[model samples]
Target: MTPIRHNASGGSDNDTVLDAVRDCVLAVGVRRTTLTDVARRAAVSRMTLYRRWPDVRSLVGDLMTREWIAVATGAIPAREPGTTARDMLTEGLITAVRAFRAHPLFRKILDVDPELLLPYVLDRRGASQEALLELLSGSLREGHADGSVREGHPERQARSVLLIVQSFTLSLRTMTDEDDPDLASEAFLRELRGILERTLTP
Candidate 1:
């Protein structure tokens, strides 16, 4: 669940808590990051922080959600004739994959506490997946109106795309067992992009 964005009493926090969560998670791991530590890092009192989030997990969950929403929103370009819905969707998924690969915090989580990430990915209607599905469904409807997407239920199509994106992007090693994991991961992404393009294109 997302924590309240504002500081105590709705002040101009400007993401101070999220920033603090990221810092604390990086400095220590998720298991060790306490509400006290986050409040100290954010320069707020523990009570003030608790007013927004009950614990560190809740706060970090919000942080991860915000980071992903940023990636998804930034992935799409302004609509134009040349940019079909498929194109926008493909680019957005690629952006997410690349962002995850490059994100220090995400990598840190993977190394320190991959189990923390699994619930969101494994649940069919988890918060993260639902957020992405909502974004994709909106784009699909727009595409249908413009005759760029197939006539179907946008939610179903979006869920399918989300599953594909998550399956391949999250499970990198299954694609290839190259000695250099970095190179293997890149190669896997290239293949994933092609598959998604074919799957989503009308």
Candidate 2:
């Protein structure tokens, strides 16, 4: 799939517009947010928004891509002198799951227009997911070289890891029980750590 492109120039106007889109979505949802509302919120002309994004869905797509990539980038574990790639990957995935769950835009989307995620979840990969897969595959390759991860095709392993992470990120709420601390989200996150460790261990 062709990745959704943000403004190639990285202009402030793009940021302004996307920020407006975020606010609109958070307030109403993707379905209810209109290009007019976004334009008004952004203080940009309707023609300006139309020139870039054809519709609210396209605008929101770019918004989500931007938000999700930012979250994942921030969640990447920094390399330390003694940190193996496997260790970094495991930590990064766990951290990303936590960050994604806590992200305001993410929570808003899940709470409101969850159907917007159906295509990415059930049919095709989105730009953010593809970006994450690239990061995961690179780290998996490094882990293999360092003898810390099991031998496997990096792309395949990355996909598997992403699948696991997606389930935890999206479906974990259903399995959690706030009433019972044992079944809380953090408990599942601990299980996720064990699962990732065993999956990558040499």
Candidate 3:
């Protein structure tokens, strides 16, 4: 993925453009948002936007990449003295699911322009997904070294875990019961935790 364009102080024209794209998507959805609208919001010339992003979809793709990467980075567990890689990876995946579901941009896109995600979901992996898979595979290798995770191809194991996480993050609402007093979604998350544990356990 294109690295987010911001310095230590967090100010850049690219950041401004992506922020405008985010606000436009949140307010009017992706289909309705235009390059002109983003330019206006960013207070930059339309030529400036066109120079960077050819269309709204590409602009939105970059925005989503930035947001999703941030979410995943924040979700990763901090290393400590005795925490096994399996435990860290499991916690990180659960945290990422919760954060993705709660992200305003993610929620807005899923509600108003879910079709925008169909290409990424059905056809090819997005940049964010590739980055996540890299992280997962590295962690799986760590688990193997520590004798915490079962022996397997780390790449395949990471893909399997990503499939499970994607299902929970994207389709979870379909299987949830709003009226259930037991909080079906939370219960299902617990099930997810168990499933990950068993999947990785030696």
Each prediction's whole-model lDDT (CA):
0.76, 0.87, 0.88
Could you give candidate 3's per-residue lDDT for residues 76-126 as a string of tens digits?
888889999999999989999989998999999999999999998899998
Candidate 3: C-alpha lDDT: 0.88
Question: Per model, how many backbone clashes are there?
Answer: 0, 0, 0
Q: Per-prediction TM-score, please?
A: 0.86, 0.93, 0.92
Q: Once model 3 is optimally superposed onto the true structure by TM-score, how far is the C-alpha of residue 68 displaced, in angstroms?
A: 0.4
Comparison by lDDT, 1 against 3, better one? 3
Q: Name the top lDDT candidate.
A: 3
Candidate 1: residue 114 Cα off by (Å): 0.9
lDDT of 1 by residue, 1-202 (tens): 1122312222348288789889999999999999989888889999988877888888888787777666666666666667777677677688788777678887788889889888877754655556778788888887787677677898999888888877776677566677898888877878888987777667
Model 1 TM-score is 0.86
Query: Per-residue lDDT for 79-158 in model 2, tens only?
Result: 89988988988988899999999999999999998999999999999877888788888888889899999999999999
Evaluated with TM-score, which candidate comes out highest? 2
Runs off by more than 4 Å, candidate 1: 1-11, 78-81
Weakest 10 consecutive residues of candidate 2 by summed lDDT: 1-10
**Best to worst by lDDT, what's the order?**
3, 2, 1
Q: Which stretches of candidate 3 lie over 4 Å from their true place?
A: 1-11, 180-182
Put the candidates in TM-score order, highest first. Answer: 2, 3, 1
